[model samples]
Target chain A: MTQPTAAVLLIGDELLSGRTRDINLQQIAQYLEPIGIPVRECRTVPDIEEEIVAAVNALRAKYTYVFTTGGIGPTHDDITADAIAAAFGTGISEHPEVLAEMAERYKAMNTDFTPARRRMARIPHGAKIVKNPVSGAPGFQMENVFTMAGVPQIARAMLEDIGPRLEGGARVHKVQLRGPGLREGDLAEPLGAIAKAYPDVSIGSYPWYLGTGDNGVALVARSTDTVRLETVRGELEALMRGLGVEPIPDPL
Target chain B: MTQPTAAVLLIGDELLSGRTRDINLQQIAQYLEPIGIPVRECRTVPDIEEEIVAAVNALRAKYTYVFTTGGIGPTHDDITADAIAAAFGTGISEHPEVLAEMAERYKAMNTDFTPARRRMARIPHGAKIVKNPVSGAPGFQMENVFTMAGVPQIARAMLEDIGPRLEGGARVHKVQLRGPGLREGDLAEPLGAIAKAYPDVSIGSYPWYLGTGDNGVALVARSTDTVRLETVRGELEALMRGLGVEPIPDPL
Candidate 1:
């Protein structure tokens, strides 16, 4: 069966300016990978309405699911909600359920539920609210587009709330081995043959700094079938041993 | 004076797959900022030839300078030279200057200069070579596009070689202020007025988690003029102080 694929749209000028370090993509990738939702694409755009609308429409039509982050705050530059609403050609209104939850949360925290704060309750019509435990402002889910906060904490909270609701495929298991002595060209034919031999598995090689003025290649085998993954891993281990190097474990 | 602008097109599948954490963009941004080149846009595409050509054409037309990283290796996926040539509607050839450098570097490092490695000596016609100190493979500069290596170390080395050759504008000075124990609404009108007052400066506010069970707002002021930047910074600092906030130093 074909695994479900998703796409992420990161909207923010801070990211473009290199002012804010983005940790969300990595975290979301890790979280979704375990659930068998492979992220096919990730695009980061400035918090401009046209850009957001264009990206949302393009990604929404292409992927099974679309996730967006940033521009959802109660500030001047927060145009995510309006942009998404505009993408779907739908009007936004104060979601009663979200409003109630925000009101209760604010009251419990002894924070005033000002009009600006209520702006968080305004979500696209027919959208579901993704609960925010850490912050009062909740995320909204409409069709396949899940709009979350730019703040890492709030994004995580919303992700946790939504992850369990989505359908998933069999999780892929991965094995990795690292070595520095051998050049990539020497193993090209053998590596290609191994990948061809195991149609069910994928083999990948990455170059990295190995310290002590050394460079190394990390070979990885990934497959949804555990047996195939293990078989490929054994072959990689044997190859490393033959090359007079010790095979290491996958970091993940 | 106009603030200099640049756009980056990262050509690689490794980044899109989340396999390689990218350090090039951050490093490039930091390197260019002090010299007054502000990177306005960044896009990452797989090593597909057409995609690379399209990205190069689109970005070069939109910005003062365009920088590209990755796909300049000896592997089959390394089609940056050809793609760039296609973008320029030119042809590719094994430039003697690049071949000479590669041979010298290989001889110095005592490594075999294989035929596969020589593939990197090819450059797009009429393009200038960007010297690579750490490797035999040289990057190239064609029109506004500065194509460099995918590896952070090599890309950085190439930047050091080429940074001095580029034109620059007035370096924008930045100031930051933080206000905790306050909501965004309370500062919206004042901040709006501040934005209106300093038409030459750009002001932005971001909400942050204090990790002390409190929330905060990070206010940033950016401008090309040193006097205008300082004046806006003073005003923002006074506003924060009045709001009972002890603002922190610029996080940047």
Candidate 2:
């Protein structure tokens, strides 16, 4: 089966300004890649309405799915919901269903459900709410764009809630091996052939430093089938023996 | 002086795969931010040639300076140099001056200078080299785009070497204050006035959890001049006091 592609739009000024470190994109990639959904493009823009709308439209048209994180909080910069509604040519206002959910959640915690807190209940008309387990403010799903929270834990939870609902492909299985005393260029051609032979599998080579005057390289073979992934791993073991190097287990 | 805007292009697949955490963007931001250079946009693309070229062109056209990290290695996927050359419509090959520098550096390290290893000497036409003190492979500077290594230590070193050469504006001074018991919307109108009055400064409001169930809102003020920044900070502090909230010093 052909693998599906996805694109990520990470919106926040703090990330671009280097004030905040982004963990959402990596988490999203790790979650989707093993399931054979590769993220083809990743763009980071400031908390601006126009940029958010433009990125959403472009990525959603090009890829099967578009996942956006951030700008859904109760702050002034929280304009993602409105911007997304505008992009889809839909009207947005404070929805009663969302207000009930927030009111219930905040009431259970004995927090005041003030008008300020109620601002989070604003939702675009006809959008499905992706429930937030950790936080009261729920994310929304519209068409192919799944809006998730920016906080890593909440984003992860929201993705877990919505991931299975989306049609997913077979998981890509990979055997990753790493060790010291190897150069990446030396194995490129052989690895290239391995990639060509499988056609369905992807073999990637990465090099790292050991900080002890030694170099390390990792060879990963990713496919939809476990048996094919194992075969490639066996071949890599044989090649390692021929080069007098020991292959270490994947740590990442 | 008006601050110059900058952008980043992180070219690699390893980062997306979560195999490596990116430090280049943060380090570059730290270096430029103190000098009043605001990083506008950052995009992460794989080693694909077309994607790299498109990103380079787009970012270069938008910002005063565009910095790219990764894909300048001695491996096949290390294609940032070639792609940058393509983006500028220039040619790239092993330059004798770069080769000579690599040869001398290799001699000092007592490593064999093989022809394959000399691939690191390749540079685009009409490009100036950014010296790498730790590694023999030199980074290149073409027009506004500075292409550097993916290795975090090496990337940081190259920035230190090249940072002083670039024109920089006056550094922006900043102050931050947080009110643990207050909500963002409660302070919105007054903060709006603060933002309106300080046209040259940027004001931001962010929510944070202080553990032990203490949640709060933080207000930040930024400006190029130290006096104006302090004045804005004082105004924010007075406003927080009026709301019966204490302003805390920003760790940032």
Model 1: which docking level applies?
acceptable
Encode model 2's per-residue lDDT on B1-252: one tens digit a residue.
556889999988777766666777888888898877888788889878999999999999989999999988776567899999999999999989989988888788677776556777889999999989877688999999999998888889999877977788778777878788776756766776787788888887777766666988888777777888889988999889888998998766
Q: What are the per-residue Cα lDDT tens digits for candidate 1 across A162-208?
A: 89777887787788788776565445445656777897776766667
DockQ of 2: 0.49
C-alpha root-mean-square deviation, candidate 1: 3.1
User: Please, what are the lDDT tens digits per residue for candidate 1 over residues B110-179?
Assistant: 8777665777898999999898887658899998889999888899999998897889888877887767
CA deviation > 4 Å runs, candidate 2: A185-200, A213-215, A225-228, B178-193, B196-199, B242-245
- Name the regions of candidate 1 deviating beyond 4 angstroms: A169-171, A181-202, A223-235, A238-242, B1-4, B47-54, B76-79, B85-93, B180-186, B196-199, B213-215
- lDDT at residue B33 of model 2 (Cα atoms): 86
lDDT of 1: 0.80
Whose DockQ is greatest here?
2
The residue-by-residue lDDT of candidate 2 on A1-252, one tens digit each, is: 666788888888778767778888889988887667888888888888998998899889988888899888776667899989988999998889889888888789787776656767888888888988887688888888899988788899999887876776777667889857877645655665676677766666777775887777887767788888888888887767666888887746
